[model samples]
Target: MNHQHDHSYKLLFSEPRVVRDLLTGFVKEEWIDRLDLESLEKVSSTFVTDDLRDREGDVIWRVRFGDDWVYVYLLIEFQSTVDPFMALRIMTYVGLLYQELVKQKKLTSNNKLPPVLPIVLYNGERRWNAALNVSSLVQSVPGGLEHYRPDLPYLLLDEGAIVASEQWSIETQNVVSAIFRLEHHRNLQDAIDLIGLLVHWLQAPEQTRLRRHFALWVRRILLPSWVPENEGAEWQPLNDLNEVHNMLSERAKQWPDRWKQEGIEAGRQEGIEAGRQEGIEAGRQEGRRETARNMLERTSMDDQTIADLAELDVEQIRQLRDELQSRP
Candidate 1:
């Protein structure tokens, strides 16, 4: 995972609206409707372990569920490869979070730990095949020992798979969905269109912070990855959403023509190479036929023998022999 992408994702999810939309849009459990999204608040993800070591999570938020609170642990997995032990890692983090909550006396009124919804947000190209529960990674013990096994499952939201799913609609106007659409865009024009939508959707004064985060993500992460290095150097820093939209719109006018020209040149080169190969093959076949003809006319070899020597088929050798006999 690129560090810049990690930082950008963290910054985006830090906003309460993003977190709210993430759960509302992706998590499809019946209990999601019972929560109060208006009570969403960012929680400190840093925790001190028993060894006095400080560990920090990516993003954490707490929202009211009836009289209690549910902690949403957002773990952003940006690596291209899947982590097989991701379930164990989530278990460890959840335990640490519980310990911190106990220390801070943030438990429910009944003196119990609150529910923690562990979510893994993966952006890798490959589908996630890792075990969702920690118990799945452990070997089943003999007898009744299986009952003592630890169990912790996380909700996985794979960006590529989710966006490609039939259930996911591009018409969804959520900001997070817009981000995903931009990430999974087919071409430069598609990306430009999505960015334009984001510009319109977030134009309200209340969404200034989220809009700024989107602009920063485009400037720092998307632009460097999309534009060629030489051309990207000429692009000035994009401080606002409109700047990003304007720059992409202006540059996109030249892309279709350049892309078409490049494609034509590539096809021409491929045709030339293919023709060269065909000519070489034709020359080799002619040489073999000449050898077979010489053997048929100058020697008493049979069609099969001549064919074997010249690497030609017996039928072809016979045809050459017949043609030689008919010629004056």
Candidate 2:
């Protein structure tokens, strides 16, 4: 019973356990399936980059499924739009995680490297199918691999309707429904519950909006309707919204998506920074004189000189300029 009006984007900001529950629900596997996931017992999540130097805690969820002896990364991304480097981002995270494991000696040479599964759960209204997204592929080509649901980091989580429906399971449905409400619902009460749900996940131990709504809905409506107030408890956790938020966020980082962002974005950027894959260039570094002379911007320089200075394909430069012009 989620309404479009009520939504909680900050849930990931608050609770880690609830987010874990959601991930556990979606994957239908123990939090430690991979050896490394269980052994490290860590979930690292953060923003894509520094935003005013304060992380938004937007890039949600990460975990390892194995014993402490070995584990890799299982990352989940919650985004409104598909970035071009989605796959590349996942690859970088998984690779870096292995490096972290090695640095900490949480995993050893004897331990097998775990596969990093990255799932991007999108909430934006537009369909994400595109030439770049691997969702459409049924097979992997040479050098390019296709990701399947069986993979730990597989996505497709936030088609929020089912998640928001309350009819869905604790892991997926509640989270999904809450997200859908952000884009669709309007009721203040509904909004409160969604917030409460997030707060609950955050493990806040106070009178959250859910409690408030339960108080009103039960006393004002459900009690009179002959239903018990306990029904809400079955779904909502009993704690302060803030506590729940922290708890949930902590737990979720145990998953991969969150851990990667923390490494890549540091602790400031919510998620936009997470979009930057290792190989992705965040635009170009413009230097006026590093070249043996320039061209176009300086015709005195030959094409060879211009190419040597910038080291850019002429076509690539043309595309970049065009792309910049198209930006709003």
Candidate 3:
């Protein structure tokens, strides 16, 4: 699930190609009918910027189109737990993008930039009734009658309009349903088939890599929280979770190594001469080597980079990595 996308945002914006396709149908025909591929901006995933120090935007994407070059700012944010300050959050990026467009000079002096579309895709399973806003948090009003309004619009992904669209393909439907399932599923295994199916659909280099990346990330974070102990006799879903239940077992064998490698390098640096000479050194190196071996077995990560991230010395990483090459 290593990707250049922000998962929450990707889940919010990309999976509904059904809607985007419907929305952009006009653009596909009228605007981008003959442009070179590179000039045209597109993605089935979310891209983000930190927008730190002064303020943060964490914007997913902004694509400019045509001689008019109207910018399309696709903003999506995900809420796993809960927070109420989201309106201010959206404004932060919407403003940053406006600032950038002015700096780029791509925007005309007289013309306004395209509208910023901020969509919030929430999956915490909490009953979110109130819209998130900064003014509400502050609670300001005239002393007399109390007239205050926070101008913010939210397109909830949890709502049926986005998730249950008939225009979505079967695989897209499975992934959308699976992600929403995290709000209700008893544990990670409760939704493994959909997880695996999403991996199948989105893992390919081109198909829907971004959507897949976010889906797996959401799955991983939810994986440890719960698992079904009841063993219901008829645990039937619209689909079956047990069908790809084995992937969870396989992934279990693999991901620890990824973690081990990441931790090993950190441990190596922190280890003093004593920590290294004591039994810790053996455990650190072994932890990393085994991790590299395990990750290589399951994923397509490059060997050297994996070593660096895992904090393994090049040789140990390579050695463990090389053994995987000779495997069946």
Candidate 4:
């Protein structure tokens, strides 16, 4: 299946209501109070690197903060593996964004750059162990070079750490928190409970838009995992919180059997991917051996030259030549 998580996340936060909830509910109140959430504007994530390569998937916003304008740099870290150099990568992106702003004449007469609040929204299965700041990856240097090391750190919103709690603001903010909570659920029952709670929070009549958006997201990206066989057609017509609860409760009866099948299928996919990689490596090695043999038979190049050209070890090249000589 083609995973659409990158697009799903971008769409989720694209709503100004969702972004406002994120900043006001999850972020510190002091930072929230400074910004005018009403003026939060979605900016283009497409940016050209120094090498002129275009990069995408990250979300950004330009908002008015008090009397000044600031940028929000949101990096969506959805890959399975953790990147140890994430801090340095964010630094480069921030620098490039500032350069773009300057090129567009968005800077002040003194050439002062706008303040950026960098945030990472990571949802990988494994816990994040990478250093939080680029300075942490830098080797300690003398006073002369001390200023060269960067010390910026991005705020991390790890889904693994999120839980549904009273601390979250009510209504849409609570629903967003529940969405993150669903990611860390231990079993189908827990997941169902969280989904039910999310629907319940959206029961307010004024929250029709939020409910529609959340339900669409759940159906598009999340339902397949919960009900594997028919792609959850039964739950597609969900209209209210009560309907969500009833559907989930009914599916709970077959969860045990369906869950086992899904687990087996997941393992089978992993094995297939591993075997594909191994076959590619084996093919590459065999091709190199054939190249070494051809060079030995048809060319005047020595073993070292053949080895260098074919990317084979000198010893392997010699062995292949010996095997060829012994064959009639």
Q: Which candidate has the top score in lDDT?
A: 1
> How many clashes show up per model?
0, 75, 5, 0
Best TM-score among the predictions, by candidate number: 1
Query: Per-residue CA lDDT of candidate 3, range 1-328, in tens?
Result: 2223344444434434423432343232454443332433442222234644443223234344444443344433344445566667666656666766656554654576655555555544454455555455556567843455446454445433334443534533444454554344433344554566655655555555455445345444443332222322222221222232454556544554545655566546545534656546766665566556545554444666567656677777677766765788
Worst 10 residues of 1 by lDDT: 255-264
lDDT of 1 by residue, 160-179 (tens): 88789736455677878877
Task: For candidate 4, write residues 1-328 as lDDT tens digits.
Answer: 1133546556777767677777776787476787887899998877897688876878889889766777888887778778899999998888888888878877754668888888888888677888888899999888789788889988878777565333544444454577676665555566667777766666777767666676666666665655545546678788554566677679666654443344344545555656887755665566566556555653334678668767779999889888986998
- Which rank order by TM-score, best down to worst? 1, 4, 3, 2
Give the C-alpha lDDT of model 4: 0.70
Clashing pairs in 4: none
- Compose the digit string of candidate 2's lDDT tens values, residues 1-328: 2112122433332343334444544555554443232223335543232232332333434344433232323333445565655555555455555665556555534575544445555554445553333333334555545434222224455455433444533454354345445334343234444655654543344425543333332222212212123333432442344443344335323422332333334322423454654323332222211221222321222344344446656555555445544778
What TM-score does candidate 4 get on C-alpha atoms?
Answer: 0.67
- Candidate 3: C-alpha RMSD to true structure equals 16.1
Q: Give the poorly placed runs of model 3, Cα more than 4 Å off.
A: 1-57, 63-82, 108-110, 132-152, 159-177, 186-190, 203-205, 208-219, 226-246, 249-328
User: TM-score for every candidate vs. truth?
Assistant: 0.76, 0.40, 0.44, 0.67
Global lDDT of each candidate: 0.78, 0.40, 0.47, 0.70
